[model samples]
Target: MNCEVYKGSRKEGAYLFVADSKSLENLPAALTEQLGDLEFVISFDLATRTSLASADPAEVMASIKTGGFYLQMPPGKDLETC
Candidate 1:
């Protein structure tokens, strides 16, 4: 799947990945408010990776498929933001 990653302004090392970088409005209001603003970081294909630096590629892809986006929080902050 084609994926785009975005950095969140409210927290360092946090990112949001989605299929369409242009439609950030589709994100949940709570999530959008928690993250503050988003900045485009990079884009990649899921078929190209076995794993990501911090998240599992398959898990990330699955989250994007089901949730419309996947949140990657920095290290221990994963459970806190959601």
Candidate 2:
């Protein structure tokens, strides 16, 4: 499956992945509001073995399939407390 990637303006390194481009109707309003502005990153093929920076491609695809979207938040700042 192909997926569209969007970067969150409010948070650095935050990303949103959806099954379709410009399709946010299925996502909750609260999530959209929290994400602020979105910038298109790129379209990716989930069927292929493509590596992501901080998330598993397989998990992302699964989320998109089940929830219509996948949220990838930035890594925690402090590992000691995590």
The number of the candidate with the highest TM-score is 1
Clashes of each: 0, 0
TM-score of 1: 0.88
Q: Residues 1-82, candidate 1: write the lDDT tens digits.
A: 9999998788778889999876587888888877888889998898689989998999998898888998888776663553
- Per-residue accuracy of model 2 over 48-81 as CA lDDT, tens digit each: 8578788889999889988889888767732122
For model 2, state the Cα shift of residue 46 in Å.
1.3
- lDDT for every model? 0.84, 0.79
Q: How many angstroms is residue 77 displaced in model 1 relative to the true structure, after the best TM-score fit? A: 1.3
Q: Where is model 2 poorest over a 10-residue stretch in terms of lDDT?
A: 73-82
Worst 10 residues of 1 by lDDT: 73-82
